[model samples]
Target: MGISLQKGQKISLEKEAGGGLTRIVMGLGWDAAKGKSGGMLGGLFGGGGGESIDLDASCLLFDEPGNLVDTVWFRQLRSQDRSIEHTGDNRTGEGEGDDEQIKVDLAAVPANVKSLVFTVNNFTGQDFSKVENAYCRIINGSNNSEIARYDLSCQGSHSAMIMAKVYRHGGEWKMHAIGEVGQGRTAEQLLPQIKPHL
Candidate 1:
């Protein structure tokens, strides 16, 4: 589970509280690509498949401004569902380079969403590695204004996991980035860290 989206659970990023708040953001990053088999671990203790986890994948935003596309690269993954899935692999330098961003159309959002869940996946099975300062922020929307920003970065690992963020600001429902790193994959392991003492 590790901060994941369950069935019948939809996070709403649309601000209908008369605040004119609109827009959703998602970003990803990774370690620097130089040594260690040119970014990704070359020889491992497993199978030999899948594309290289190195290099950068261009960002794709929906209903965005002109000539303002392709925010950055972060070795994004090709998984189930593009817009909703946030499992990207960035095997590059740590700290900072260029944050990868993706935007969604606020007006085009579904009406069944109550909150938005922002998930990140960058487990490369290589200890002694670190991933720092990776997250997403809302930029703009229908009212020509910006909303709140979320922090989606955390410690690094070598397995598949997710961190979900649900937010409620000023009587408005906003999924402010709530990503986290855990031991295993399960809602039980993550729910505590996310909504502890609840």
Candidate 2:
């Protein structure tokens, strides 16, 4: 079983997996909160329903100096070096499992790259209070086994969350659950809030 992480908690990737973690996937999932009234027409006509909740998952690559070197998100699905790639974007959190997934090859990561930050934002401008059963999980790419998971349990008025970070620690990679809340419709707007967490 994988470790359940709390805010600001950190764990070694290699240690958790019992071996080197070369390739990994950061999976994010969530469910849209039900409207105060009715099914679909009620929400569309009188309540907050029918409208899709567009949540975007993003990965920011930072160098040793904490400077952003690259990004992988909906618009830009692949990094320049191709070390990271976003599987695809999920406009609504209506699916069964992961709404969005980002794959990373640790061995292929550039020497200068030291940190990869994962973030999620409500592109539709809906607050997290309208989102339920949200979680971010790390999975071993080779065997598809979960290594760690962080649950976003608290509902907030914010539209964005800095979910987690995977960084190099003493020649080994470590993962940290950040869980910081902020206001942003896109990843670019969350940069200011994300840097502080790094």
Candidate 3:
């Protein structure tokens, strides 16, 4: 088990790992909201309208001045410098855990890169009202131990969320849970909402 985080909470990776940490995995998971059943007739005739939600997980690398230096998302699986890599896109939030994952090699990251912001977007245009159990977690890549988790409990008409950020603080890396809901179908569209947090 790991420390569960609320919105705006922050945790230190080195402190949580109990020593130096080199690599970490940021995992995002969610499920489509189950549709209402229309009684026995609906079940027999397949009237339940539960549809799969396509949520995209993205990592944006920023410099000290908050400029976007690189990105890793569905469109681009790896950052330009090769320090951050996204596992790939999962169209349906169907499986048990980690619908999408982005791995970061902290040591390989550039010195100027101060923050890695993680965001989730409803690429299919469905609002979060149609999604459930969305969460972002950080795992120690070495031992697969969960360090921290932030449950995204915001359910509304928004299409995107600036979930959390891993940033350099006093020569160590720390994670802050943002959990801010907004309107964006892609990482590029969410840039404006991310600056305030950076």
Q: What's every prediction's RMSD, in angstroms?
A: 11.4, 2.7, 3.5
Whole-model lDDT, model 1: 0.38
Instruction: Estimate the TM-score of every prediction.
Output: 0.44, 0.93, 0.93
Model 3 pairs whose backbones collide: none
Residues 60-100, model 1: lDDT tens digits: 22121112121222433321233332334445534463345
| lDDT tens digits, residue span 40-120, model 3 | 634542456666679999999999999999989999999999999999999988989899999999999999999999999
Q: What residue runs in model 1 are displaced by over 4 Å at the alpha carbon?
A: 1-18, 33-99, 141-153, 156-171, 183-198
Relative to the true structure, how large is the alpha-carbon lDDT of every model? Answer: 0.38, 0.88, 0.90
Worst 10 residues of 3 by lDDT: 36-45
**TM-score of the candidate numbered 1?**
0.44
Of 1 and 2, the candidate ahead on lDDT is 2
lDDT of 1 at 73: 26
Question: Using TM-score as the measure, what is the rank order of every candidate, best first?
Answer: 3, 2, 1
Q: What's the ranking of the predictions by lDDT, best on top?
A: 3, 2, 1
